[model samples]
Each structure stands twice: as structure tokens, then as C-alpha cells.
Target: METRKLGDSDLEVSAIGFGGWGIGGAPFWSTEGDNASVKAIRKAVDLGINFFDTAPVYGFGHSEELLGKTLKPVRDRVILASKCGLRWSREALGAISKNASRTSIEEEIEASLRRLATDRIDLYMVHWPDVHTPQQETLETLVDIQRKGKIRHIGVSNYSIDQMKEASRYGKFISLQPEYNLLSRSIEAEVVPWCLANGVGIVAYSPLASGVLTGKYDKATRFKDWRSKGVIGTFQGEAYERNIDKVERLKALADSAGRTAGQLAINWVLRQPGVATALVGVKNERQIEENVSAAGWAPAPEIDARLNEVFARE
Candidate 1:
């Protein structure tokens, strides 16, 4: 496996990282047990996946807990990244409203640390922006954590260009995690360019577009999730179908390159500038193996160009 520098930070991680969402098992498609998730995680680390990204809100802390127990033995060997900004109580799973107070940020970090069973986090990020909380206050909290050695690097996820710039004012943010893939290219217009110019690394999540890029779902297939029940997957029916077609076209390209569509999608994100790694979620060893192989080969220029063309049509 190859490692890349995250922004100007000294931390180097594999080109592909394991997104710990699926392993935590909630609000997503699959719900594997902690033991199964742990097995998959250990396999990933053995195969050279040194970076693992997770959030406290995921599975309402279940995700972090599982990662903590499974990766504790190799805690020092891998770079663990988790986020704050979203608050959750013992009863609920969503954020405690978009209000991120300095106190809340501190409390969340402390709680996450306990769950992850680590003394320090390699990269700590703000999971989402809080419209009610002052950006300065949040950034100040992050700076405080870094100074205390509780966190090595700072990052922001799902932030706009202006928000990222404002956060950068407090200190150097080493990375940014956002929903980015062939189906979700909205970040490319401004966020990506800003990160590249400022030397902020991009950790693209949902690189498979929640499995749409796997070419498994079609017009006949129905998703049983909030996303499908919401506007994007239902109201934009034709758009979804068109995206599927694009995935099929890309699948053909992947076949020629001797890779799966999922692998090609991961490689496409890796080829982009400022992308330190693509956080792919997996339930078993097969998925992990396929994703890791993307790091072994870079797609040809023509294949890359064709992917761009397909996305342009979307």
C-alpha cells in the first residue's frame, strides 16, 4: 500500500482508508455484529489500511466503541480519525440540533476519547457546521484540544468553502471529509479547489454513492432508507436512473482495466488532487480486498477521461 501526506501535516496514511460506518451497524444497510465488524477491521489493518474514519453520531457511539475494542491492540500502529460537532444523547441518534457550543464540543471530544479507548486522536474533525454556534468558538475549542495533545491534527467535514476558510483562521486544518463521488460532485465546484489551494487534504466519504456506484441498484430496485424516502432519491427519479447508467458505463471501463466498478470509483477519487484518501465502508473481507486493490493500480488517462465525460453528462 502507498501512503500520502495529509495536507502539510506530518501524518501519512494509505491512499484508501476504511470508513467505520458500516462496521458500527446502524442507520445504514448492513448491521453486522461487533465481532464480525472487528474481524473485518483487523483484516483491513493486516492488509495495510492504516487510516480509519468514524464519528460518534454513527450508530450513536456504537461505531466508535467497536473500533476501540477491535483496533486497541494496533492503536499505535494506525491513524484513527473521528469527528465532533454533532451531539447525541443516550436516547437519540441525530445531532442535538445544529447548535455546537464550546462546552458541547469539549464534552463530545472527551466522550469520543473514552469510547475509542485512545489517549490521543490522530485527526479530530467537526462532523458538521453549527449555524447557531460561532465558528470562532468551535475553532478555538479544536485549537485547545490540539494544544493539549488530545488531538494531533484538526479537520472539518461537510463544510462549505466559506466555513472551511473561517475554521482555517483559528489554525491549520490538515483535512476535510465530505460526501463526494460520481453521484455527488457538488463539492468540486468550490470546496475542492479551496482545499487544494490551502493545502487541506480531502477525505472523500460515500465514494460509492451509498452503493449506487456498485451497479447493484436499478430502476426496479427500491431503497428502504431516509435518503430514498426523501427528495433526492424519490423526487429525482430520472436523475437517479441517469446516474445508474453512468455507473454502468464506468463499469465497462473498469472491466477493461481489470477492476470492479467499486474499485474504479475508488481509484477515480484517488486520482483527484488534494484527496489524501477515499474512506470506503466494507462488511466483509471480499469488499475490503477489492477496495484495497484500487491502490495497487492507477487508471489509464483515457479511462479517467471517460469517467469525467460520464459525470459531466449527469
Candidate 2:
């Protein structure tokens, strides 16, 4: 696997990292058990993936606990990145809103440490922006944590360009996690260019367009109730079906290049500048293997050009 420097920080991570959103047994999605998830994670490590990204909100803290147990033995061998800023209660399964209060952030970090069974997190991030709290207060708290050596580096997820600039004013932000894929190109307007200029690494999530680019779902396919509910279902409706046609066209390009559609999609994101790593969620060992193999193969220039043409038409 190829390794890239994480922005301006000293940390270097694999070009492809494993995301732990689906491993926590959350109510919103069907996921694997602890043993299965751990097996997948271990397989990823064996395949040379050194970066693992998770969050406290995933499975309402269950994801962190699972990650802690599975990766504890090889903690030093990998770069662990987790997030804060989402408020969760015992009765709730998802994050209520963005929160950056001193007490709240501290409590969340302590809990994450306990679950991760680590002395310090390699990359600690604010999962989302808190409209109520000033950025300075939140960033100062992060600075305090850095001084205490609780976190090695700081990052922000889902932050806009102006918000990122404000954050850089407080201290150095080494990374930013955002939703960037063939289906989602909004970040190209400003976020990608800004990160390139300012030297902030981008950890791209949903690089496969939530399985749409994997060539698994078609017009006749029916998703689970969890996928059909709320935003997930609404987003996967007609527009998604239409987008799948574009995916089908791209799959032909992948075939011509002798690569899978998923690999093609991931490589498209990895080819972009300022991308430190692309985070992928896997449910089984085969998925992990397929994703890791993509790193070894690069698409030809013609395939890359064709992919851009297809996306442009979309």
C-alpha cells in the first residue's frame, strides 16, 4: 500500500484507510458483530492498511469499543483517527447536534480513550461544526488537549472553507474529512482547492458513492427497510437510480481497464491532489481485500480521461 503524509503533520498513513461506521451494530444499518468486525479489521492490518477511522457516534459508542478491542494489540502499528462534537444520550442512537463545550468535549475524549484503550489518539477531529459554540473555545480546548499529549494531531470533518480558515487561525489543522466522490463533487468548488493551497490533507469518505458505484444495485433492486427510511432512502430514490446508469457506463470503462468499478471509483478520488487517504467501509474480509488491491493498480490515462467525461455528462 502507498503511504501519504497527513497534511502538515508528521503522521503518515496508508492511502486507503478502513472506516468503522458499519461495524458498531447501529440501529440504522445492518452490520457485523464484534468478532466479525474485528476479523475484518485484522485482515485489513495484515493487508498493510495502517490507518483506521471511527467515531463515537457510530453505533452509539459501540464502534469505538470494538475498535479498541480489535486494534489494541497492534495499536502502535496503525494510525487511529476518531471524532468528537456530536452529542449522544443513552436513549438516542445518532448524534443530536454539534457540541464543542469544554466539559462535553473533554468528557467525550475521556470516554473514547477508555473505549479505545489507548493513552492518546493519533488524530482527533471535530465531527461537525457547532453553531452555538465559538470556534476559538473549541480550538483552545483542542490546544489544551495537545499540550497534555492526549492527542497527537487535530482535524475537522464536514467543515467549510471559511470554517477551516477560522480553525487554522487558532492552530494548525492537519486534516479535513469530507464527503467526496463521483456522485458528490460539491467540495471541488472550494474545499479541495483550499486544502491543496493551505496544505491540509483531505480524508475522503464515501468514495464509492455508498455502493452505487460498486455495480451491485440496479433498478430492480430493493434495499432493506433501514436503507429505505429517512434520508438514506430518500436520497437513494429516483435520483440515485438515474445515477446508477452513469455508474453502469463507468463500469464499462473499468472493464476496459481490467479493474472493478469500486476500484475505479476509489482511484478517481485518490488521483486528486491533497487527498491523504480514502476511507472505505467493509463488512467482510473479501471487501477488505478488494479495496486493498485497488492501491496496487492505477487506471490508464485513457480510462481516467473517459471517467472524467462520464462524470462531466452527469
Show pairs that collide, candidate 2: none
**How far is 21's C-alpha from truth in model 2 (Å)?**
0.7
> What TM-score do all the candidates reach, one by one?
0.94, 0.94
CA lDDT of 151 in candidate 2? 93
* C-alpha lDDT of all candidate models, in order: 0.83, 0.85
Q: Report the lDDT of model 2 for residue 75.
A: 93
How does model 2 fare in lDDT?
Answer: 0.85
Give the backbone clash total of model 2: 0
lDDT of 2 by residue, 1-314 (tens): 89999898889999899998888665645775677788899999999999999998888888899889889999999999999998765534443677987888999899999999999999999999887888888899998998999999999999999899888888778999998888887788788889989889999998887677888888777766345655432246678777888889988998998889999899888888788899998878889988887775678888888788778723
Q: Give the TM-score of candidate 2.
A: 0.94
TM-score for candidate 1, please give it: 0.94
Best by TM-score: 2
**C-alpha RMSD of candidate 2:** 1.9
Please give the distance, in angstroms, between residue 60's alpha carbon in candidate 1 and its true position after superposition. 0.4
Residue 28 miss distance in model 1 (angstroms)? 3.5
